[model samples]
Target: MAGSAHGDIPLTTISFSQRPNGTVATVTVSNPRKLNSLNTTVLDAFLSCVPPLAQRSDLRCVIVTGGLCSVGQQAFIGGADISEMKDFSNAEAGRTFINKLHLACKALRNLPVPVIARVNGHALGGGLVVMASADLRIATSDARFGMPEVQRGVPSTIEAAMLPAQIGAARARRLLLLGDTISAQEAESWGLVDKVVQADQLDEAVEEWVDRLLKNGPRALRIQKKLFAMWEQVPLREAIEAGVWEFGTPFEAEGFEAEGRRMMNEFQMQNRQRKSRL
Candidate 1:
């Protein structure tokens, strides 16, 4: 993983492989050779990759990152290849482009299990939007994030409906209105990212995150995750009522309390056994 200066930018490409454990799927945005720009071809490849991997019951987490040697030199995705946009003219063309972008984002959002963005480098403009679709995101200290579409004479389209909820109005406005890049640390502060670690430590950190996530029961995690998602659309009171009726009432009236009692008793018995062994 040498630095990008050694004619490695074209090495910027995307690939996905499942780990031997079959629990985590790793998607690499290579082209540490080209900085992994998301042109139409790359986007099509990425969209194709996401669906099948997402359907796997064996998968608990997905780790997305850049190729080795990808550091401060280039972004995880630089942006849509500007050269590819030369033919855009009519409203229909613009709508089609935006539709593709929206579907790509939606695919990630709709993934049943968690997706972790192991951002290995800069993620600007459309790149940042792509990163934002992940459920959890860990950025390296050298990672850069922004939405500089305005700088390119384009409006921030797909994110027009999503960012405000994740980051709140003020922070979203600052990023979207200005179309500026922010340090990984700053992104964490604004609630756009989870944490920033040393560049060399990103892979280990992502694995650690997945380890923690795997400790939870899959069904419980799915229910709770959807619970949080439902909170966004309905009003607070209505959400609370719906949660009480749909989730809380069923669980509370079901085996949860009994399970808690049983678990506590089992834990006490285990403690006694350990003491006797001592």
Candidate 2:
């Protein structure tokens, strides 16, 4: 449980812990002063911490969550630190600041394995965009979500564009344009969050997702995730063609064909035994 500092940014900490089985990694974000907000310093630390985890050979899934609140409540990311935005006087400076945030989000999305947002508290503005970028999201019932950037005099950009694909254009507009925060149930109903549970059940819910993802073939899962991202940008016919290409990629990987043949043989054997028993 010993944590290390990222460079000299002691207040902003990113910790990673691998499960005993080595299939899952849990990344905890802690910045107690701002409810785990992503300031420039924190964005740097996050960019440094995530890319290596994404490249791990043994990793199958990732659970990203914020540090715990004092009362033992799970404090998921609050959003980008507004305090840091107050002094921005030029377009170039603003662009530089936003690019760092984009890099952090890109690292999470680029992970070959599924990245699950374990949302246990408020996820606003850029925080909501981070949740949107995850392959899957599970949240506590009390978790709140919004795109409040408009209220702060800034438009939600970067991965925030993923909102429409996540919750449909209409619902994405409600949050992005109106700056409305939705309850966890509402988020699920809108298809923003995949699952919602009680606060105490959050960890169990996340484990369930990790277990389910781990059950899939790792190469197939990686291909599927890659295609899913590609689908967002490509035309329908091209996307279908990409899927066909990915379908054949597993066979190109050594031993995949042999494994598939073995599994099919086992399935056929089981069917024959069942018929004989009948």
Top TM-score prediction, candidate number: 2
lDDT of 2 by residue, 211-245 (tens): 77776667767788899889988999999998887
Model 1 Cα RMSD, 1 decimal:
5.2
The C-alpha local distance difference test score for the whole of candidate 2 amounts to 0.78
Candidate 1 lDDT, 1-278, residue by residue in tens? 11123455343223444545347776655554446766555566567777676667777767776555344484566666566665788878777777776776777777777889888788877778878888899988988888777878878878556789888888788777898788988999988889899978987998888888776555445556666667877899988887676554324434545433444567899999999999
Model 1 regions more than 4 Å off? 1-22, 30-33, 68-72, 245-278
Off by over 4 Å in 2: 1-22, 70-74, 253-259, 262-278
Clashes of 1: 14
Residue 97 shift from truth in candidate 2, angstroms: 1.3
- Give the Å error, residue 39, model 1: 1.5
Tell me how candidate 1 scores on lDDT: 0.70
